[model samples]
Target: MASTDAPPLDANRYRQDFPILSSVLHGDQPLVYLDNAATTQRPRCVIEKIVEVYERQYANVHRGIHWLSDQSTDLFEEAREKTRRFINAPLREEVIFTTGATGAINLVARSWGDANLQAGDEILVTEMEHHSNLVPWHQLAERSGCRVKFIPITDEGRLDLEQLPALLTEKTKLVAFTAVSNVLGTINPVVEIVEQAHQAGALALVDAAQSAPHGRNDVQAWNADFVAFSGHKMLAPSGVGILYGRASLLDAMPPFLGGGSMIHRVTMDGFEPAELPAKFEAGTPPIVSAIGLGAAIDYLEDIGVDNIHHYAQMLTQQAHDVLEEVGGVRFFGPPPAEKAGIVSFTLEGIHAHDVAQILDQYGVAIRAGHHCAMPLHKRLGVAASNRASFYFYNTPEEIDALADGLRAAKRVFRR
Candidate 1:
């Protein structure tokens, strides 16, 4: 039997690292933050890293020979190395910086998809995809004359893996899916999906925006051809994200944007693009946020990713068990064993936004509405749902508070 015991963690100690967690809201009630899936609060270390870069070493990277520029450039490249190590990418140059996961997906769609996909080629995605993952492919298909298809999810909110074999075929050029669903909390079987995609001669691109924070996104283990995730989703600042592509494949693709440092030489007519990562990262990159992301990576490593994953799983199971006992709660996705530390559900008669607003009165914060997964919400037969997502810094007490808040919302709505 699988172990039910959760690994021990000093969540209070971890909570102290995030200064914003100390804030009291809605009168004197302590804040109960359950929205880490949107963006995690930054720790002191990550905040300090951002401040350090701006206060001490801020400069445009890659062009200047002065000391400040040299220092800033070194730190910027070091962050790339940090990201490469964070996701276990095979090579440092394989990690390309972008605006966010949305930008990263667009990069892959425009550069690789445009170059490789033919008129009749098909790109396979999941119905559970966030708009970031789905829209880019749709746009790509519209431009390149390729078809976009979806892998259906079961009633339980898990991908119907039995259909994978039939869905994957010679005409399928790529299979783009999320490693974890932002709405359903479903953790897809990445290794199985990647292997199947490869067997069918299709590349795999994993949208790891949700899973990256929980720390199980190992590109080497999954053998994914491309992966995209946001640093902000993993406790760093916003406006920075990563795209990890196989070095050889990245080298072969055309550049997504043309400008500045991404080029080797600029003629009056055409310019030759730079190599590997720089080829994709055009203009001035998000230097300060990248450095902060590096610090965030360092902070997570110090806590041990495996430990965080276990604690988050425990929290998910605890919340799931408690919410299941609530009278009107209807949960989405598989059980905690197959999901991340996320619980999306609906209360019997209350609207999702109203539930969230009531929870806010109790100082509990959660996400509501389509959560950028309108297709998945449509599949689940609901226009919106309430989502309480957890992280290592979250506590059982907060989950309890969430349950209390839910009951309170129900009582208010029942009146």
Candidate 2:
């Protein structure tokens, strides 16, 4: 449960923190940014931190004894600590830095899949996963002689949890799925999924790319074996993401990349891997981006995640009601309060690309396409759809802008 009585988020004050939001995209109209599912605008605090790191302390981390290198290394490790605490992980050693969510999931599949999976083993995933979550496992199955299984999704976009009992078995090696569907905005029951996976002697990996932006994520509470998310979607810079694995699991998994910092000792015969996180993080990590992520986390903490969740729910509910009244729009997702801030819908007799273009002309930005979940779209029997995803900084007025844009799109395309 989340607290609703918290004071209003001071949107005006918070809006000031993101300077780019004030900039005009078409030189006249304000940018009604609804494409948060793709990437979020960075706050001034995060930008400042990135600039500060490069200007004040720019050096290669982990090998130099000089002052600048030492300082950079300290700041980078501090960022890792911030990530661990943000997710409520029991140990900082469990956090591994990667390029983004996609890279992190690939790391898991490559390392753990190679080490543990044998011929005829099965990996279970869901239909609502982003391509990042699905492709790696598919590739792993191809290479490791493993098979992939999918959990079906209902027409309303919820996972058919009742089917899980039959899906899990002793041969199941891993169960990887998204915490929330990026396109449908479906919030999966992660705890129940984890419990079911463990019951069958399988590990669980959660793709938290969509959930982390709108709410608090406690890896311990979910008891997930591994969780991955992107920083850019959570108000930080692009090119940096996190992978949180239980310390023991990460300790046993082999290194994903073989290079510089991940080696404790190099021999002519072989190279010994470094400790827990370093073992997985090869080469020079994204130092400045990690610092930016730390600042972004601090900014979110100041605003309070609970308030962000409430604000998003209010916005989505308002849009749902308006879109329902419009009569031709069909929305996909869990009911308003039960999901994240994303809303995906398709209008009858209107192509998604045309609708998006018309919306852009009105200074309203929304995502339009398969949203990287092509299987889910195919399951839903639609070629594509338009999505309007919200964040803490978005206002109710923007929702009205989206509605007006949709109405205009309908009129323009009604030939």
Candidate 3:
């Protein structure tokens, strides 16, 4: 059954903006790229933005007074401003650039956690966190003699919200969780969670690696202490990530890395760090990637994030319905209404990798494995699963192709 209420979306025109979408796959099959959870295909604007930077205005930022350096610096800072407005941050300096989401999370766990957490403090994370969000805290706990605790998840892959209040206590130093689960596709209640954390006098950190690409990310509205996301996952290039920290909190925390541009003054004995953002962003930053990210933001804004989110939800619903009728598919997450645009499942008697390979033969790109959420996978009692994540450019016709490809995989496996 197709959704009658799905908002009208012009996917054909949007697909034209991504050049790789028209390319043929595996002999003659059309490419049905569904591996968006890993990374989204870059639009022509974003690609050209990177190329234009390298071809014309490439230079080191903030150090030299030359024209190329000044141009690069302005573009780089403009990217920060773009991101700040994109997420609705109160201060532009709060948006710090890093290598990726992993780097952003590690920055908080190392700098903020080290400065705030003590021997008896607790760091609360949820079971559905990606390793990038979980491991850094675990490392912090090991070093600080603090404890790392996880909020449980329901069988349907929803966060067990009822248990959260009891878990949060006066000893809790921070509540770190994902805005959207990478594997489960569950959109967690960020505002509610942050409120709870504040009541318990703890800071809240949101890993928006999945959520930032799908919908609005307002740090002010959520009252989040920190928010982290990667540009590549949102149609920008890799090697660039964002860490949105509260100005006061960022100012209090020590520098994570030490080098050029992040220092205000240096003596033979020690050094003074730069202001918010640059204090955390040591060394030369990802100049071209930042410019590309700005262009990606511009592209998304032109289409509107709300429209993309709604269309993607409709596509997710279509895929969920088709897969549910396939007879042997076992789903890992909540129903489509409860999820965003990701669907993770397994075909009976067929390994996830095998399922993925068969689908690839049909030119349908999908992901197979734990998706860097091994703890969540372990809790779900599945060793691995196949995932098909959708973006706004995806269509109902593509969902049909995915269903047909899955049926072909079933036939090949004799299941």
Candidate 4:
């Protein structure tokens, strides 16, 4: 069992680091932000770092000898190194900056898939994957004449691990899945999945968008061929994500995009691509956003990932207990203790959209929709559901507020 008594953290002091959390929503109500699974609030350190880069070191990197350009280039490379360490990649050169998780997944589908896959080859994914993880493999399958397969998911929203051995075979080219379900909050056994993929002679890719913020991630331990996660979901700015691939795999895969820095020589016949990460990062790249991500990682490190994980789990459990006491609410995902920081459910006889609107009046902000995991929602026999995702800064008082809002919603809809 994970320890709940994390090193003493000043929640109030840490809350001060996020400016948005201090703001008044709808004129007077304190914001109870439960949409963290969508995007986390950026800390002041991250915001300040992004602002500083544009104000102080705004210049194109990698090709200029001027002071501003040199400084910008250095900062950009430093950010890459920071990301490398944050995910525990073997080499900094393996960290490729992407527009976001979607872009990173697409890069793998286009570059690696196109290079390695052929007709009769199969790319196996899970039924619980977000659309970002699913569509890329589907497109890759269509383009490369490869087939797409799905590992079965249980009624409880957890992957059926017992079914994995049967799903994987010699024809399997890659196995991609989410580390945590965006809607269900099921923490998939990534290490076990990786081992299964390797035993079947398939590459493993993990979509870490939902897991990276909550715990320490070591791709080395999982032995994943590629790992992709967005910065915005981890309290960093939008427009930046990290794609961590094995150095050999990244070196061998063809470039996903063609443009400025991704090329070594552009002849009339063909263009020679740059090496590793540069080959994948085609354009000028997200300079300021990368700096913000580095600062976000720094902020998370200061608080300690273990502390964040423990606090979030406590908050999630509190939410589960409160919601369970409510008469009309029906919880989804693994039982409260087995899941991560996300709680998703539906209210009896209430549309999810209606639930969201009613909750807004109390300033209890919870997300209500398909949450970009439509197939998972469909498999669970629901069109949509409400989701309340917690972070380290969230409190028990906020959970009470959410319960009050849900009660109010039930009363409003009961008529």
lDDT of 2 by residue, 244-276 (tens): 999989988899999999999999999999998
Cα-lDDT of candidate 2 = 0.90
Candidate 4 residues 1-415, lDDT tens each? 1334643366778889889998787888899999999999998888888888899997988888899999999998888988898899989888999999998999999989999999999999999899999999888888889999998888887899898999898999899999998888888899999999999999999999999998878999889999999999999899999899999988888888899999989999999998777888888999889978888998999899878887888887888888888878888889766667999999999999999999998888899999998888888899999999989888778899999999998888773
**What's each prediction's TM-score?**
0.98, 0.97, 0.98, 0.97
Candidate 3's displacement at residue 38, Å, is: 0.7
Best by TM-score: 3
**After superposition, candidate 4 runs with Cα above 4 Å error:** 1-8
Which consecutive 10 residues in model 3 have the weakest lDDT in total? Answer: 1-10
> Against the unseen true structure, what C-alpha lDDT does each candidate score?
0.92, 0.90, 0.92, 0.89
lDDT of 1 by residue, 294-339 (tens): 9999999999888888888888888888887777899999988887
The regions of model 2 sitting more than 4 angstroms off are 1-8
User: What TM-score does candidate 3 get on C-alpha atoms?
Assistant: 0.98
Task: Flag the better candidate by lDDT, 1 or 4.
Answer: 1
Query: What RMSD does each model have against the real structure?
Result: 1.6, 2.0, 1.0, 1.8
